[model samples]
Target: MQHYTVIKDHISSYPDPIILRKEQEVLYGKEDTQFPNWIFCTSMATQKEGWVPKQILTTPNKQGIAMATKDYSAHELTANQGDLLLGLEHLNDWTYCKTENDEYGWIPTFCLSASN
Candidate 1:
């Protein structure tokens, strides 16, 4: 695990984030220009929407129907500035992290700084 300090406060945008199972279908939306490598997606079954890593999505056809390459959880962490966290996984400029309180979720990389 890697340590990080929250440089900027981040509030969870999605209280109920999207979840994708392997090979599950989704509707592809727009890509996030500010944060590259992430695209908006809505699960076909659950209809929950969130930003998912573009790499995890299969190429969409003309109808914007795509499949998930693997399981993905879009949960996000609500962290305050100066908080310490442990990042367990990193993908597409986001980090899967656990807060000091043991609450775990994803946080944007830009909000975190490497801790010594």
Candidate 2:
């Protein structure tokens, strides 16, 4: 896995993120204008809502009901400039990363730089 240095500070904006199990059903809400292919959703089980990638959810019907394609966690990492992180997964415009302190969350690629 490649290492990355945070070029900019990123704070976790969404305090309560969406968590879903595979095949879990959800009710879709609004689409994120800033980030395409992502929509706000509330899990049918928990009723907790957060931004979710369209790639991870099945298409919703008229009633806005759909199923999660895979297990997902909308965790966000808070990192300061110059912090080192290990890249785990890259999706949409965000990368799931683990920090030196062992915290794991998704961070925007714009805030990170590849390190040799």
As for candidate 1, its clashing pairs are none
| Per-residue lDDT of model 1, residues 1-116, tens digit only | 99999999999999999999999999999999988889999999999999999999999989999999999899999999999999999988899998888888999999999998
| Model 2: worst 10 consecutive residues (lDDT sum) | 29-38
Which pairs in model 2 have colliding backbones?
A: none
Candidate 1 lands at a TM-score of 0.91
Clashes of 2: 0
TM-score of 2: 0.94
For model 2, residues 1-116, the per-residue Cα lDDT tens digits are 77999999999998888899999999988988887878899999999988888998888988999999999999899899999999998888889999888988899989999998
Question: Model 1 — which ten-residue stretch has the worst lDDT?
Answer: 96-105
lDDT score, candidate 2, position 83:
95
